[model samples]
Target: MGDHAPDGEPPPPEVEPAGRVITTDGLTKDYGAVLALDSLDIVVGEGVTGLVGANGAGKSTLIKILLGLLAPTRGRATVLGLDIAQHGEAIRRQVGYMPEHECLPPDVSASDFVNHLAQMSGLPRAAARERTADVLRHVGLAEERYRPMGGYSTGMKQRAKLAQALVHDPRLVFLDEPTNGLDPAARDDMLELVQRIGHDFGIAVLVTSHLLGELERVSDHVVILDSGRLLRSSATTEFLDSTGTLLIEVVGETGTQDRMGQALAAAGLPCWPQGHLIAVDTTRATTDRDVHDVIRDTACDLGVGLARLQADHRRIEDVFREGGDHVLPTS
Candidate 1:
């Protein structure tokens, strides 16, 4: 379900859930004079929603409160229609969490740790072992499932953590910085695993990370937080729309970059040099249909071999900087 708030404001109290999987009402938390979370209200749909913010943006505090690890100083919350206050245990039973920090025992193997977690979630001994094997393989830890976690690389250790989270076959999972400290390839693999956990397994995912751009490729929706308040929340497509700014790519040395910019300017296209790229301001590029043609003509006129040309899509970070107002307002 999606938010029904007019002008992007927080949905009203009387607004019924349109298949909303999670909701918070006037949630607040304070650490003495420090307000960790304001009167925050939010609605989460039934797919992967990325929680993005810098450190101390109340991301961790919000997670703790939702998980029932921290009680709100004011207001209330519900997950899967289960009140966090009254159904903490029941909520936890169906929700799996992969913490940002390392929590595995050095002496234990991935198989051992996952099996134990599965049993803790109330799976029987034999079933826990069987489920553990499936989860480990799903996270791509087949060969090293029996090896001690202490010897595992950061990537391997992360996979083990993910395995344990999936051992119980949760309906929803929270992954905190699952790609932290991994190389590019490993990060991509982890992202693919996360995508499958949400789409293929039909499980809801609420993943958090300090890096905003990283979630763009995988998340179905994104929630931006700042200073313990809701900054923005919207479908990924809203932020990734490329209907604005002109994207231009030219071939040649750095000198070609300047030549292209000068050529576009001579033709009255409001353009600027953005590192190796040239960004044309489409706010006044004749018309939307003519923008691409203008870029192509300018590039050819400069004798600059064009490599790529298209509308510039806003990155995740761009949306955050502009607040949700640029795409959708905060009601």
Candidate 2:
């Protein structure tokens, strides 16, 4: 069970009395020679959960099946507890979708497009326009909402796409690579907006992305897929163990790192230089006293101020590296 909540906080108990916003049992999809989804089983509830994998890892296949856009070759799935195979029209009414590829019409203004979508979702014309405007402003696209999307930057285009998805006030949203092609600052802004959508608005979000590191920062639970199979699924924090390694940052000349490495080794510590920093790899059995002694004497002998020494946070990439799955080779 993937029980970890976002940012180390406990998730609220399921609001739906029946529980499980989404579930799939033995869900399978095939493309001739390739099995896109191999009898995959999954469960998702309220709040934000990340679906992550490299391209062609069946992330897209799973989303398409869940959205009822593609029928599974075998097995079955339910969205909001309604069988997608039989209740696809009903499911689409409550589920908002932001597809991965670009689908916006270049000639239309975002305000017009979003308004049109809102109305299509069963809102009255007046209410659709109002909600469209609200959603555009919420996604930081107020200034450009009226402008034709063909001239808009990639970031602006993305915001326009997002505004359309939220215009319908969907109970659950499927966001596909919401940060795709964004610069660092824009990507951060998009992530914060995603978190806000799930937490502040109380909407269930199932977002998919290829960037493992960014997903780790925002998702409460992370599900990893490999070669169309479930490689691992668990709470994000659990994926990162509290390894007792201390990442020490010392400021000095070029040889300072080398000197510190030499000094720590000579002092009977199995320390090594890592890029511009030094890392003390403590074993599971190593005590706090062992780290303290290593840090204290090593800094004093090298005459380098401690600068900073804190427990190293294991990154999501580290887990994938250890899992021994290879990435698809590019042609």
Candidate 3:
């Protein structure tokens, strides 16, 4: 028997299954002649998993397919152990979604909008109203919940959208570019809220972003896509781990960084000046001759004060620029 009931029949009772929250196998989608998603096989567990890619990398397409808003050309997927092909409605009932584009009505107040959505999710009138208020407060829109959405700032509008998604008390949320058009502070606030949703409320979150580095702080795992293909998927810690490069900062006159770079290079250490700091290649450094000791001695010889020295960690972008087994072909 399938996970869901037959067509036109009511779905089976919703149940939270153990382990992976989402899994896809050989998922492919083509928009006419253009392939939007290639053969993608991924497993997403609990916590915040960041979906990262450049534009037109199939991030949105995958989200739509998972939500049952669009059908895949090939392969299958399951959310919370319910087949998306057979249990879309059941899956949607247990999951929340925040779309990338603006879909809010201009004249409606946030409170009313959220309340209506909560009721649609099967909450009673009183329960819907209470949830609306609770989610609005949680999203930092309690003070502006009564105002028309048209009058709300960009941050407020984003928060209102988030509030509606959470009003239903979903086990998972798919947030597509939740930090779209906000200032740095607002973006940080949104990220913090996303972290809270995953950590505090225990809601599994799948957040999409084109900006590679923005999700590093909040996401427990990251999935990278390139031109409709999976590039890499791993724990965020693995991406940010030390890259065997030592970042050395010297405190001295304006010419200090260049001088240190020259000294280190002359001392047989591969080093380069990197915007006020010098980066020393430590991949070849041996335990008998520590890279840190070499740097310290070089700085002392040049009479430059060492400001800071630490291992340079890799960023998500490095996986693209630096050739790695995890990287996919751009062509």
Candidate 4:
């Protein structure tokens, strides 16, 4: 059944929203002496943008402020062009949120819960039921949609949460760690669904996660936060670009790589361990020590044969390197 007016007329068709999905200017939140979010100024456009940080790094706080569930101490923000402080209810009506914590009822069936939420969002009972069944099937929960959620596994529970968020056909969604407890295969499946929501359905998405490398795959843009402050913000390809570093792999005894890295470091070559290979900075060479010369000498002194030497591309982990030059993306 389709949504209809009380006068027996069909409801107005949904319109696709345009412009920036979210924007904040000097958004900050604090609890007494502790600061949770610090002066966050960012603009998120369409597609998937990953809000990445550690557990206590204000990722959740930022989302709450944007959703108008929590107030910011000293800044302004807008969601879909409406001021959060003034149009909170209106904003919530057009946005779907999947929280990080478990909030599902033990005895409620997935079908019932999603259908009820759809009705609450202003759909008629018949329309809500039809929408719920479709959304549940889209999330891969069609076979077990009627089972009580308390008996579902972690992956199944996650699918149920996703089903509810999409039942209302919101223009935007905020998914807080949708892959938190899922296995590798489940996580991949969920990420694929997230991509489909953004690209196929044309819904703006802001997904949060603690893993930088994992999000880099699905996120169009990545905004990294550290200690409640903006660390770096850029497109996904910027993170994977080449850093002008040479990867040196060696063939030797048991601890050859570690010993080689230490020796290179002592020779004033900026080198670090990347898995079993040593990554040396080609740009950080000093006048006294020729970086390439030192590496050759070190390998000869240690009696380790240099197996490979080639330019290495930057990895997401380099974002945390102590002296890395993390350049934010230009608009």
| lDDT (tens digit, per residue) of candidate 4 on 1-331 | 2333334333333322555888889989997777988998888889999998887889988999989999899999888877787667777888899989888998999999999999999899898999999999999999998899999999999999988888899889999999989999999999999999988988889998888777877889999987689888888878778777999999988899999988887887788888888998878865386667788989999899999988776766665664365332211
- Candidate 1 lDDT over 43-110, as tens digits, reads 88877888887777787788888889899999899887778887666667778888889999999999
For model 1, which pairs clash? 8-331, 9-330, 9-331, 10-331
Decide which is better by lDDT, 3 or 4. Answer: 3
Q: Which residue pairs overlap in candidate 2's backbone?
A: none
Off by over 4 Å in 2: 1-19, 249-270, 273-278, 284-307, 327-331
Best by lDDT: 3
Off by over 4 Å in 1: 1-18, 248-280, 287-308, 320-331
Query: What's the residue-level lDDT of 165 in candidate 3?
Result: 83
Error (Å) of candidate 1 at residue 301 is 11
| TM-score of each model, in listed order | 0.78, 0.80, 0.81, 0.73
Best by TM-score: 3
Candidate 2, residue 26: CA error in Å? 0.6
TM-score (C-alpha) between model 4 and the true structure: 0.73
Determine the backbone clash count of candidate 1: 4
Q: What is the C-alpha lDDT of each candidate?
A: 0.81, 0.81, 0.86, 0.85
